[model samples]
Target: MRAPGKLVPVVLLVLALVGCTNMPPPPLVTTPPSKPPPTKPAKTSEVVIGVDGITGGYNPHTVADQSAVTTALGALLLPSVFRPAADGTPQMDRTLMRSATVTKYQPYTVTYELRGDASWSDGPPIAAEDFLYLWEQMRRAPGVIDSAGYRLIDNITARDAGKVVEVTFDKPYPGWRSLFNGLLPAHLLKDAPGGWDAALEDGFPATGGPFAVSRLDQERGEIQLERNERYWEQPAALEKVVFRRADQVGVVDALRRGNDQLALLRTDSVGLSLLGTLGNTVAVHTVPRSATATVLLRPVGEDMSDARVRRAISALLDRDALVATGTRGGPGSTLRAEAQVLSPTAPGYRPTRPGGVSSGQPELAQAEAALQQAGYTRGAGIWMRDGRPLSLVIAAPAERESYVSMARELQRQLVNAGIQAKVETPSADQLFTESLASVPTGQRTTGAVHLAVVPRPVGGDPATVLASNFGCLQGESAVAGAQPTNPVGFCDASVQPTIEAALSGAVPVAETLTTIEPVLWREALTVPLFQEADSLAVRPELTGVDVGRAPSGPFDTAVAWRRAPN
Candidate 1:
């Protein structure tokens, strides 16, 4: 989901002004090839950014169509009530919202006040109806992507003639801040026939943020955003921003050629060797992203269904070695050996490596012993039980090249320990979208996917990720049904109370996470591999660049960016 496109209305206005000019035309000017007429110094205030690619349609709610580009665009153009700070704390964007307060605890209720001056670029007030519309779509629309926290809200109503919003919940929700981060204009979406899909696709709507989409060229894979005149806050520092599509090599080339000032590249996308070559030409910043690469064992009918088997697999793999190999031993490469879902950098996070699991040092003997105790014998360099080999299939998303390398490494380690394992690299759509749902009771499992190497972003609230991924009553638990984030079908009734307690603000977050971390480790639901660091190349003069926990990249704080003294 990237930003949508149309020619800027301002372009026409400039043309009309030129046509009505009364001054005599100036004489043509020319310069020799050796000394070209001083090209009116390219706007120093604007920033040109290069991204991986423009793949999905520009709709974040359209689950399957969302992409990193879409999330980035939303940060720039959409109306967000709260924006995450560098430390992953929610900061109220006073331009869009005045305040949000919890007025009641039991049958939880919240009151929100929107800025009186905040209105969409098209002249509609940013009101409670917009929040209500987003909530209704997320709760009712089947195609909507992530509705975890939104579904908890019971109702929302307008007060003070649409200036204030009052929301009531059926149960306590501590992660309320995560909801309604990006709100669509109600006037445009509420009455649309196709609902959100139609509204999001019918040209990006006029926005209320610091910037608005001025042009989107799909063929050239570029999007241009101009400062929003209707913005209620201090104006954005840059007058215009252009996002261009580029691969790893292209990103480096664009930066070197002075065509782009900023670019984000994955370590795997551009090898460490290539990054090192840039040297003094560009400054590399290792931004600690919230996402972590993990290995999820399917809890359905397979040898991996047994906790012992899963734990044994966890013990055998050398996560440090995997990270080293996958990242090419880069400067920021390190293993996320903690069994918990929270990133080490996140608040309330604690290291919890399961007692027996060897992260950097492989415990092949212990792994084999566990397999033997489970009624398996080594034969022909593979474990066999009752004339059947202990075979498993690991699925990796093809788009993430590092995951592919890690999957192969995992397969090799398993085979070395007398286990038959195979790695299958599938398209991102197939691995993330198609294979996320649980297999029906009487239906055949798709591809018999035994394990999946996936990445989950642990945003500002670690509790949100914990609840969304591991809670018994939510996510992809057998009881809660399947969701894309929780396809492993991990369910423990005992952990539900703690999860609910933490989410409802009844228990201390650290205490709840401390209680739940052990459960995840004991069940071997997921093997935390590493916290992926977002790599960015920027000109030395650029200032106020910050990579927050959101998936929107560094542009999450684009409004604050400026050029430093040269």
Candidate 2:
């Protein structure tokens, strides 16, 4: 239920580069300062970048590329064919391509004219052949992200001595600019292993992105990047940027002390505290993030599995209460409730009911009757189902303070209803794998996963969201349950046609939602959670810090963002 999606690899690329050294270091964020908040901000000096360790390989094919990082990196080089226009439409930047045109009929082809002046960071002129190479590689590459986009292109033809690139799609495939989501080093990858299924020795040799990785400290989990002076856009104002791995609290403290310029705040106390104290700071820039967090009411657990019991539990859960008391709606008032995976910023956004936190569906009496139907009796202290105590384990990433805290609150509320609830939290890594992993498929992980506090990127449209992340979903609904354990689970039987229609750039928003709404209402795999606000504490001198990409992603012209007195 999110956009500008970053597919976290659960089964894809698992191993960190063991022997790949000449390989480009884990992609690092090039900053006004690449290093962590130094003892103090430099008057005019190199920018240091701070980031978490990207252990599972930074390859784009792998779901774990954490694409926002790559998008930021790509900002310096190739521009997306469709950039977010001021009018809320994704428009083609056309910096590399002189012009792109698509005819409505036959093969559903799209042809692009390359700007003769455009060149790779290495100085090789960009030709239509470069687009061919990218498409071919996308088709053949095993681990590439967004297979759907690649699947659409039936054939690639290069003409005019490889200066004209024409692509033929299988059907009336639309979504004209989705191809721009990809960033390529066309000159080098042109001859490498077609689809980059595995780590190529030097697949990322050419320089084009805003920053080219310069140093990597695997042992210490540190990375350094240098700006691409050859970048097509204005070269980065700063000389260097560095990233160091640090936890949430440490990152927050660094930001406060001016040691860390900015942080990609994950779900943790740091974000919470920042929300708590936002008013006291310069300004905290928050936005409607394109991700969802949900709770799957399981009826088959020890005390669950009984539909009646599950329904009772579902009815009793005052969703409004949770929206009011739990998550971001706490004291700081940072959380925003939403419907569907589309964030407010995503195109065609409409607020709807989340999960089964049913609106206008009160259930004190309904819960009592359902419990009785499940043969559950409300005793003095606990709930009784067949003379046994009704209890459930609210699984969550135990290591995440934010989750654990929310779990405790949930447990308390559940206790009042005579159900004993406990939190089972795991480490951050396990948390992701567990969320992506499913319930038992006949004793195997069936992807019956209930919920997670995952953050989704929010810069693009819903079509972009489906192509990037959020195809996998939870429960036995038409779309999600139709397929067992969707790797990119975003199943909405009705949504498929709209997606198909939207891809062709035809379906209107009202029509697309008309089809998508029923399936969503039927299976609440995704619940509306609190919205994220734009919260950034900046010095008055720091001008041009575009708040375009927040939560975590590239900002418009982040590198050009000056530290003032320019």
Q: Supply candidate 2's per-residue lDDT for 282.
A: 38
Tell me each candidate's TM-score: 0.82, 0.66
Task: Give the TM-score (vs. native) of candidate 1.
Answer: 0.82
Q: On residues 1-566, what C-alpha lDDT tens digit does candidate 1 reach at each position?
A: 63344456767887888889986677789985786677566667788887776655566655444456677778888888777866668877777788998888776988899889989989989888888888987764543444557767888988887989999997888778877877887887688787665666534767878999898887788888999998888899989888898777787787777788887756563455566687886787676655677777766555766777887787788877777766665433753547566776676667887667675778878887878877888877878888999888888878667778888888888888878888888776566546655443223354677777766556546666666666544532345433333456555555666776777778977887777777778777788777766577787767788756655668777898886533
Cα-lDDT of candidate 2:
0.52
Computed on alpha carbons, the lDDT of every model, listed in order, comes to 0.72, 0.52
Choose the strongest candidate by TM-score: 1
What local lDDT does model 1 show for residue 379?
A: 78
